[model samples]
Target: MTGFFTVCTMEEEGADPVIAAFYRAALEPGQWHAALRAFARLAGGDVACCFLKAEAGLAPSRAHICGLDEQAWEDGYRRYYHAIDPGYTVLKQGMPGRMYLMQDYISARAVARSEYFQDFYLRAGVRYSCSGTIRDGGGLTILSAHRAAGQGRYDGRTRLQLQRVLEHLPNVFRLRDTAQQAQVHGALAWAALDELPRAILLVDACLQLVFMNQAAQRLLCGPPLAPSLASATAAIVLRGGKVGVRATAVQQRLAQRVRQVCAG
Candidate 1:
């Protein structure tokens, strides 16, 4: 499991918490906001975001933002300003795992003069940015940390910390993909089982019922199996949360069989 991760020793004490947040966000995409918050805190930025960069002339998608007005940012920046932003262009062309400061692509004077900066960045209160690309296969998966106009640009130490975090992003993406596939396969398997005509009951090692199909439910609700059984209504009874046979001898036999199967 650990083999999938990049080998990097993060000297900062915050590394573990940041990594944990990223992994949690990977497993559950809704947690991305929290992950971004952690990223922002670790990188010493006011805001952080993750977004996918598509082909030229196209707006980014799957944006997870923190410490900003989400709707306004998406509407103004992604929909309009992204196409004209030089920093974004540089990010699109930047190498994966390599951090790029806004200053590297466009000078502060140039940014202040550009329409993209005046109309969007100034209005958004974000002037300085440090960003990096993690995955750039079909589309670029970019992570960016933003600072307000007065706040200083991300320093060398912050850049190094972001780099360390960037090294683990691929593993997060892989884990998310694996989890999605597993969920898809699980749904399909359950659907197939539900459609089966035969009664099916899934039980644990102690014959405790884990799951039952529609056929199993129907069968369990039907008439009693034999008059000789203790219970006249049904052959199977859910007693103490375990699948139980009404007849004593049959219950013992079922338990024995289940035990053998579990052992094997």
Candidate 2:
């Protein structure tokens, strides 16, 4: 959501840089590794990972991880440990934007006895986990932060921080899907968009204008929707580098709709 970006930017004079990196990764897939590392540090986690959980199984090839071995994740965990992982099962059922602690669902003693823990988790040095479902349509996109044995379990403070971050995950997922679609179609897609009769505008997570089709440009410059002058009211206006509707009632409804779309 755009509100998430605004809050993060204003909090403690921009102490949390992870939010910016997180959004960047949504736009550019290659930045995910660095984004995960920043996220792990912010959550006080030793490792952070994000992957899509499909009906078949976890798609390890598409996973972005920090502080974990890629080979072990693909070969060892996906092949053997995924089915036996209690944490994985709980995460699969977790509500989008809600955080879940593995310790709450299963006891430490139970985890110690499990083959998944003995064979994979113990080998990987991961013991405690805090995860949440980001989006669940075609597949479940899960974001998880893990703590090593000596690091202890995630505390209340950590959980609160993680939950705040989780609120923005759905927006990031939406941006990623948009980016992928654009990449798939390339410049031809832009040309097609320009020819559409309806006015179209694309904004970033921060609500900054990124692209506006020719129709949108014409609409903005048209007489009925012309830039507002103080003496005469106009349907639309551009002020302070942002688009605005002159009518308070129309503006309120438009803003609400924008927030709903951005919240995704």
Candidate 3:
């Protein structure tokens, strides 16, 4: 399990609560906001983000950010600054396991003049930063933490603390990837079942509908009733009281199938 992450700048008063939050987040990558927020709090920074490298012209395969709105990140930074981000270029060449403070690769004076910094980071209020890269086969994971202007640079102690926390990030990411793959596989299986021509319906123990395919949705219910297989069948038999023989037979078969599925 990933351990607690602590920073030199934040008050010790809130350390216990922050550490607990980090543990929960590390175990569940779906809680990206929690993870990034915890890291930002630890580093005394305004924002933090994680990036997964991607192929040319594509945005990072995955981007998790804290303290920044989705619109600014996706529309502004991802659309423009990503094309010529000096920090990203530096991350591409960074050695695995080593953390690089912004000052090491780009001087403050140069950052002030660079288009990426001037047009994006400056407006975003990011000044001091530290980043690290972890290479996994052909993939790269980058962690970028930043402080707003006037917050001063990360000192030696902060750097050491960040390095310690970075060491466990790869393991946490591995768990997240595995879970995501499982979800994708499940979705694919359901999609294949949905493509069948028969109006299939899966109902629960209470005879309430759980799932219905596109075919089932189109066949059963009309505008007046619930547009679903079970509801349509019920309305036809109980309310209309004049369903066709073939239609009634099909409904009976569907009911039997639902019973068999629920039994198993």
Count of backbone clashes for each model?
Answer: 0, 0, 0
Compose the digit string of candidate 1's lDDT tens values, residues 177-264.
6667768676644454454444556677787777776766666655644655424325567777677766898779767866775675
Tell me how many residue pairs clash in candidate 1.
0
Could you tell me every candidate's TM-score relative to the true structure?
A: 0.64, 0.65, 0.59
Q: Give stretches of model 3 more than 4 Å off.
A: 1-23, 55-57, 179-264
lDDT values, one for every candidate:
0.72, 0.69, 0.63
| Candidate 2 structure quality by residue, lDDT tens digits, 138-175 | 67777888988888877877887777667767766666
Candidate 1 ranges beyond 4 A from true positions: 1-12, 186-264
What is the TM-score ranking, best to worst? 2, 1, 3
Best by TM-score: 2
lDDT of 2: 0.69
Candidate 3 TM-score versus the reference: 0.59
Between prediction 2 and prediction 3, which has the larger lDDT? 2
* Tens digit of per-residue lDDT, candidate 3, span 1-264: 111121112234333334434334543565678777877776788798887776354566578899877789898877877878887787767677777888777987898789988888888888878888887546777777898878878887777667766765664555445445657676743453355443444445434555666755565544444545344244332224222223666557545644664675
Q: Model 1 clash pairs?
A: none
RMSD of each: 17.4, 10.6, 19.0
The Cα error of candidate 1 at residue 247, in Å, is 56
lDDT of 3: 0.63
